[model samples]
Target chain A: MAFSTTIRQAYQDELAGLRTAGLFKEERYILGPQGADIEVEFPAGADGRPVINFCANNYLGLSSHPDVVAAARRGLETHGYGLSSVRFICGTQDIHRKLEKRLTEFLETEDTLLFPSCMDANAGCFEAILGEEDVMIADRLVHASIVDGMRLCKAMRDTYKHSDMGHLRDKLIEHQDKRIRMIITDGVFSMDGDLAKLDEIVALAEEYNAMVFLDDSHASGFIGKTGRGTHEHCGVMGKIDVITTTMGKGLGGASGGCVSGRRELVEMCRQRARPYLFSNTVAPMIVAGTLKVLDLVFASTERRDRLEANTSYWRRGLTEMGLDLKQGESPIVPVMLYNAKLAQDMARDLFAEGIYVVGFFFPVVPQGAARIRTQLSAAHTQAHLDKGLAAFRKVAGKYGILGKGKREIMEMYGK
Target chain B: MPIDKQMILDYVIREYLEEDDDTEITYNTELISGGIVDSFSMVSLKRFLEKKYNIQIPDADATPEAFDTVNSIAALVERFVKA
Candidate 1:
């Protein structure tokens, strides 16, 4: 039996609204390795040469690293390409064990468990651990995966008004008698390019007798002096209870994720977590590639150092241009534009100028919080950063956003 | 003793649970797998039961079977008060 005509019309009508509202994402076809410069072929737009990439999450410049590629090739030669089974069912290889151990040691955690993706790691965590009697306090601005995980767990869930320690304290007091309480937050908020106050969270958890869970997907590969993530950045590396991160964004841009914590907690999750227990394991080649990336991260600080330099150069240049960049040290820099249409227009203009950056608007962020989400990479050269900044200034000025310098041009319209 | 089962059900459906306006949930609504109550909704339900009924619900009673419907949640609430 075919569906009713009303059902078909309803779906089509809803999609039409999305198009009219300018919220539909236009996916670009990337034709090169993830790096500072990218080549994209658009089906609709005017054909042009390859544009520079400013939106990738390849923070450490290791996506196509020779060592990482070589390691993946070796794994392919030795263990074959894919593991058809889950981790417990003949999918756990020697490299997986070694990588997990090395991750735990590198993060200074008791144990670690791997997952197919960071999204899975997050979605599997809350349900595996929290019970109905427990209480979970989370930051309001955490990742969508963390929110989904919290939705799947039967714990008393409450969110402290984003990064407000006083509100967090009040919630802790209200749930003081709960069996167990966990404070969950992202190490680096993706959109706003802000770092969570880890010192404050750790201190609050101590006073409230709560466990802490930090999803450091954005900070994992290149934050601290040793690149150990938010905990190391905050100088509380051993205090946090759980650390979840993804290998897709960093660690050679391979697809994998992990959660590191107490051995007992890791064991419990392995047995009970729905996604980890049911899903296929990380491919042998990906695991080997990740291990090599980790080795590179530890051996030399060049990648991280270069990333920091690129971030500062871009941020300082953007700031000097009088653009309102969110104040943070993370590589994710958001150039705020209060109007969604303007942000989209600015992105289109930037594309015309051979720079590729994505504009984020409401629904992704709160309404009126639209901005260009510019991501920096160690792969970005001095010339690349300069070109990107120049493009941004030109586009932003064209929109009358650069202030009195463009005042006469905008006033000519007699608005 | 008389219990306000309607208020209890409404609280569970609106606040403790993520209810859909597209569907109607009677006092005897089954929550789990029916898409009425998820894990987060279950947590909120537990909190509501504890706060409104003034009873502590143990883990054993926190399963989908116990919170299957408004009747089940009410039944669990009743059991908690008795215990």
Candidate 2:
């Protein structure tokens, strides 16, 4: 079959336009396992070097932990590799059920169902339960997966301004005529690290007779005192109707996700969610590694405590250096550089200085809101943070982006 | 209610660009193409216009040419209100 020349030309034109607009994305090659410090292979035959990584979602630094690796090895020995079938037919295993139970206990939910990725979990959840008569009012800044999921459903969709309760209340009132209403939001806004006001959302949901859904992917392993999730952080442990999150982030930095909720909702997802029904079962290695991760998280507060300490210390260090940073309690810190070109240049300079962080601009965020999002992990030591701060001061100073009298301020604060 | 261009511009500035002081947006400012307003914000803007003007904006007419600038948005509202 001959392909159409016009269609090919159209796609090529789109690619060229993207390049011209500076919106084309490129991937960096990692030479080793994911961790606080990683070896990266830069383009142009540059010698690979170890850089302090600040962009990974390995919040607790358990991605390459020894115990987790051993558990995954054990999983491979016992359960082999891929299952090659979906959960219902011949793919369900004892470990899958055990992991589900552990997740339920940890999240304080009635039931849990696993998916290949949180993207899939979000994709499958909405369409399965919501109908044309229903309405889904989401926060404007919810993750792309949730947006795509909402698009797939027949629900009358509306979005309130990000974390604006008044706007949310207005939206709820606007959609009051719908048969069923569900309020959806992310537990933590990834870019800004600001948390969803779940207590306020819950109160609004109660007043409007709406159900609440939270995707806690960014907060699952290290948000609250016990690290149970944002529900625990916001004092709404059992008030949320559904919670979906990922193993790819704070949980284990692997590939899997789940939706935990009431027994009836979970049962409905198992029966009707297309991704859960059609996709192959999650790999046994990931399941086993995640099980061990849960064990570590529950056994002690050591990692979470260290993570909190690291975040505070790093945040303080940057503030003292007079870098413009978004104020938040989450470990995801965004250093604001409003100009897109400046953000990209800063990221490149930081990379050259042995710091690995990505710049988010334009399409990722709104215009005039470009920034470099730096995440903290428990594995980052005080020395690592100090070095990273020094790099920031040097590069930002070169670009004349540092605040006035920052050097004197740093001296006053004194390392 | 009668549609007003200044009123639409005031609403956009207050709602979306209140914290932004570096750039001043006028009636002819390119919103969609310039990335000042994104798709999600467009939905909110549509709803706001619908409610305030007491008119319906079909999804098909909610394009950049119709709603990218304050002037265009006001024109769209006027068209719907007249209809």
Candidate 3:
């Protein structure tokens, strides 16, 4: 009859089991602004240690940019704080409309509808357009958010092998009986740091007469020649039927997302997407900040070019150090260490050495596919990279994983 | 005289597939969803097959069903192999 015996006890046992399995995730607090370098307080309640950060999605290094901060401040002065209601209510401000317009231009879409986050955009977009007659075939490695979004929709859910156009084509053929077939994928695979091969995907969609849905969250700011997105990068900008992206990562790293694509589809989302209809509107500060971010990215390709160069430099450094890495063109660089314990231990030691990185292992990634995901930014300097590389060498030397790959790591420490 | 399927199976087991007590992988075992070879590893497996067999499996030919088993994988390789 007791609360402890009935509900709390079962939950406690599961939590304890997770801890025993070494799968429990702990939060490391960041004491300062997010950037290439940050002060972190690990294990909590400890003094913040300054470290060169290599695990942030702040790809453009504009999270704390002065101009963005100024723009946000101006927005606060003009528009005030919380919207307290959804966009349909009195929450729709001039700034919000301006941001939507700018985002439409930036993303090269007919229309755009803002969401609380890309997660919301993903959650809301599917049910808004598709129904029981439709089929949503997503890439296997699409982000978890997309999977959840699909689960919420009435459309029958299916998946193709990640970036496998052949599988996608087959799925298209299998589902031709459906009224609508939408191919969904992430513009950039966040964990593996690989691209979605949008060129081939678009070609397949065109051949099958299926619409395409892309979550450009990771590629929104620095992917294309001028930072339009994977659509522009793949030269299929206007052809995509739906694109869901976030301002939380590559934009200003504040928080906001949008579903941008065909005018009718976006309007459908605005009208019926549950999150859009229920959730409070994005803060005015974020709108102004993201607008500035758009201005900065659209003004020039300096940040994108720098990010590409930085990726090359970091990849070269890690490769030369004999650390096995995932082959990728994006800023997400994962240094392979097959064993979970080794990945965690190496990340802990790297933290101690004044370099901040996270160990991704089972549950986060697959078993025997553990690694330390190092994300590069235009904010990262040559000196910062040199220090990070030095720290990596020191930590990898400690673990004896240098020049070792998955097989070697597995041999050294059982998978 | 030609490439053996066991060779491909061994490489797959060694590099990608993780077999359990009841699910030992052989020539006909499903390798994509069944073998638990995730999409990321599938890419690596495709590359391995290409290099080992001296063939380039085009993206369109690298379907989940085609790469579902060692037999299908072998067939795919033979299709692209110079005869």
Candidate 4:
């Protein structure tokens, strides 16, 4: 008749342990919409601090764009706010199909099936296509969503080193004893911001007669020359067997995801994936706003170009400051602070200097690999970049990590 | 010249695995099974060995069993390096 004290005490003890280890995470409250500049109220009930944001996934800065908002309003007016059923029921609207078709064209895949988020797409895609005799080989550093998706499958799981083709090739060979082999990777690894070696991966897939599955959540609307994603960026457009991407980041910065790839695979997901079969459809307004985002990105690479240029500028600025960074070619730049407390302390100090960045520690990254991950956006102005750099410089100076690299930081903090 | 086993041992204990001044990691110390080295760190350790020796250990040979000890890792590296 009452809640169990045993469970409550167990959780409380675990939480207290986390806080003692400095691994406990505290979330900041945002008083305004998503953007390069936001009002954050931390420690609860504190005054909102106006700061330049460097941690959001709002890569194209379209999260709060006026056009996208108006399109969402229109969608709400036309289709109402909610879909009370799943895709196969009364939920499939004309707008949903339109966005799916648009995504297939945008991603250069044969067909598409929508999901509520990339996590669901990741969870749903594997079980739909693979069987017990198959093997799903993924990168060691692939997203957790993919890992969970693989766990749901009857197929066996093996992992290659991050971006290690030789290792992947070994797995392919070893799993040659199986009926099918699927190579799973993130087109852009969100943490390190490195593009997967897709060209090489595709070449291996062709040679080994394996299918490739990519989760391009971080690179969908702003990666390639035409913003077609990693396939386009890597010259392997039609080669990927299953491509999953999100409309939540670069698309509309709202919420929706899709599995776009071989027509049969997409169709299979639509028919068999449990999430697609059971979950409520993505909201009509999100689909509508995403469609508008598609049009804007497809028309010209203006926003994409801005994001790329900003990434380059930000990367250069951070490098010039002599900060140790994980070298990559994506908009996510992590300022490596090997010590966990040092990272949290730096982030807190940076916030004090009117910059918003979060410290990523163990459980998110590896135990020794703590960092402050900064993201660049098309929404950011040169002024925002300059101020962010200034804040970073001030904080780095305070922590005495300004010019120190990984080895030095680790030595100081005993990683 | 043959690959330096001592360097490999020291690097693994110091870089990949956290070691204090008195932490003793002998050639026979269990690395993976003893929970000192995880799969992710094992990959980085593999990369370090590959880079230092200028030889690639095919992923099949780079298993947890082969990397469970400093001696085992050195012996694995010697095969490729000597070849």
Residue A60 in model 3: lDDT = 92
**Which stretches of candidate 4 lie above 4 Å from their native place?**
B1-83
How many steric clashes does model 4 contain? 0
All candidates' TM-scores?
A: 0.82, 0.92, 0.85, 0.86
- CAPRI quality band, candidate 4: incorrect
DockQ of each: 0.07, 0.53, 0.04, 0.07
Q: Predicted candidate 2: interface RMSD? A: 2.4
Q: Which 10-residue window in model 2 chain A sums to the lowest lDDT?
A: A406-415
- After superposition, candidate 3 runs with Cα above 4 Å error: A1-6, B1-83
True contacts kept of each: 0.07, 0.53, 0.00, 0.00
Model 4: per-residue Cα lDDT at residue B13? 62
Best by TM-score: 2
Tens digit per residue, CA lDDT, model 3, A1-415? 7786759988999999999989888888988788888998878899989999899999999999999999999999989998888999888999899999999999889999999999999998999999999999888778888878887899877777667677678779978999999999999999999988898988998889899999999999999899888888889889889999999998999998999999999999988999999999999999999999999998989998999999999999999999999998999999988788888899989999999999898767765678899999999999999999999999899888888876778899887
Q: Residue by residue across A1-415, what tens digits does model 4's lDDT show?
A: 5669988898999999988978777878999899998999988999999999999999989999999999999999999999899999989999999999999998888999999899999999899999999988888779989988987998867777678788788778867988999999999998888999999999999999899999999999899898899899999998899999998898878887999999999999988999999999999999889988988998989999999999999999999998989898889998899788898889889889999998887767876788999999999999999999888888898778878887788888878
- Which regions of candidate 2 fall more than 4 Å away from where they truly are? A4-9, A404-415, B1-3, B10-25, B48-56, B74-83
lDDT string for model 1 (A1-415, tens) is 6788999999989999999989766678877667777778875574645899888889998898888999999999998988899999889999999999999988899999999999999999889988999988888789999989988998868776567788788878889989999999999999988889999989999998999999999998798898989899999998988899999986788798998998888887898888899999999999999999999998988889999999999999998987877789999999877667777888889988999988887677764457899999999999999899899889988886764322342243221
- What tens-digit string does per-residue lDDT give for candidate 3 at B1-83? 36579988887766543234233777988777653675444765786777787787887888898888889888878878855
lDDT at position A134, candidate 1: 97
